[model samples]
Target: MKTLVIIVASLFAGVVLSAPTDSTTKDSQENTYSIKVSDHGVEKEDTIIIDEEKNIEIFQTVDSDDAEVVEDFDAGLEGIIPRNGDSCYVKPLNSGENIPPAELKSRLESSGSENVIQEQGDKDDDLYVLAGGPIKNRAVVGETIAEKCEGRNIYWLTLAEDGHQDQGRVKRSCYLYYCSLRVYLGKGRYYYHCYIVRYLC
Candidate 1:
């Protein structure tokens, strides 16, 4: 009886060891795997198939909202005009004259209350004069003036090329003021001498 049992155990062990390994039967088997991925708050599911030759094929399914296309829009400087009841003034730009801050403050105060500085041009319009030579950072100065005096019809006057070419005018102007008009004065070969004038609302 013992000999028979040992023979049976030996046969069972041989059969288990000789059984086909997973790799040997892999070609006859097919596997399906599901994978999930999330990106930018969107979740997606993918299915993979392993064929007999161990080649993988993938298919993906995504929600309609996740695949949607979006567009961006930008509106620059549109509808930025000052509202009603806002006062406007032209801050003068004097070339080569360094007016003290105290003087400027006093001038602004006097002008605000008494309107000491008369309008340069037509009563209905405002005129700013840029009298001297070419100014440095003309664009930057114009932008600053425009921001300070809003809701006003502004004008800019700069010396023409003829005046800038004259050598006798030893005084060089820097940082002159210009109007708030959205006019594009091409920065000519010479520095621009411009003025910014603001009309009262």
Candidate 2:
């Protein structure tokens, strides 16, 4: 807590101190703020741009995804949805539509999002999921994950967005140009997210 206060204080002081030295109108409008920290011989800088008129801020990390908002969920394996036996539907299943986790994961396999599971007697595919997050726009989720696929084949380019209970299936499908499927998490507020389907890379 103390360290955070110090950093915040330093940032505030720097901004105020620079106000008089910088006279360009464009520079004042930029509202671009950067903070650099040195700890144990390691130095890192983060840039944050604030748009006062829009009441929004964009955060840019040194070498990571640009997060529009600070997310309260994880982005690892099954970050959006975990691997549990109990199944729930993010969207109303058809009278006979029952898509399980394994099948859903299979659709996204080419995405290179799966991490091998070490369980015995289970075909070595213990767990699989399409995971990455905290990005502002769901539309770019696919684009963002594509950059992380080093040399592996990208079979899936996915996008997950929240679905309001009032929205109809067709409306949602049209929103995503026909989403392949939805993955419900084990338990959490984000269990209602729908993960869009296969856009190969």
Best by TM-score: 2
**Which 10-residue span in candidate 2 carries the lowest summed lDDT?**
8-17
Residue 113, candidate 2: C-alpha displacement in angstroms: 41
Candidate 2 stretches with Cα past 4 Å from truth are: 1-29, 63-201
Per-residue C-alpha lDDT of model 2 across residues 1-201, encoded as one tens digit per residue: 111111111110011111112123542332454433222234445454443332322334332222222111112111111122121111222322323333322332223222212111211100112233233333322322323322323222233333222122332221111111122222110011122221211
Candidate 1 yields a Cα-based lDDT of: 0.24
Across 1-201, the per-residue lDDT of candidate 1 in tens digits comes to 111111100000000011112223633343443333232333334332323332211122231111111000110111112233232222333323322223322232232211111112211112233333323333333343344334444332433444323222224432212211111112110011122222221
Q: Candidate 1: minimum summed lDDT over ten consecutive residues — where?
A: 7-16
* TM-score to true structure, per model: 0.17, 0.24
Distance (Å) between predicted and true CA of 129, model 2? Answer: 6.3
Model 1 lDDT at residue 91: 30
- Model 1 collision count: 6
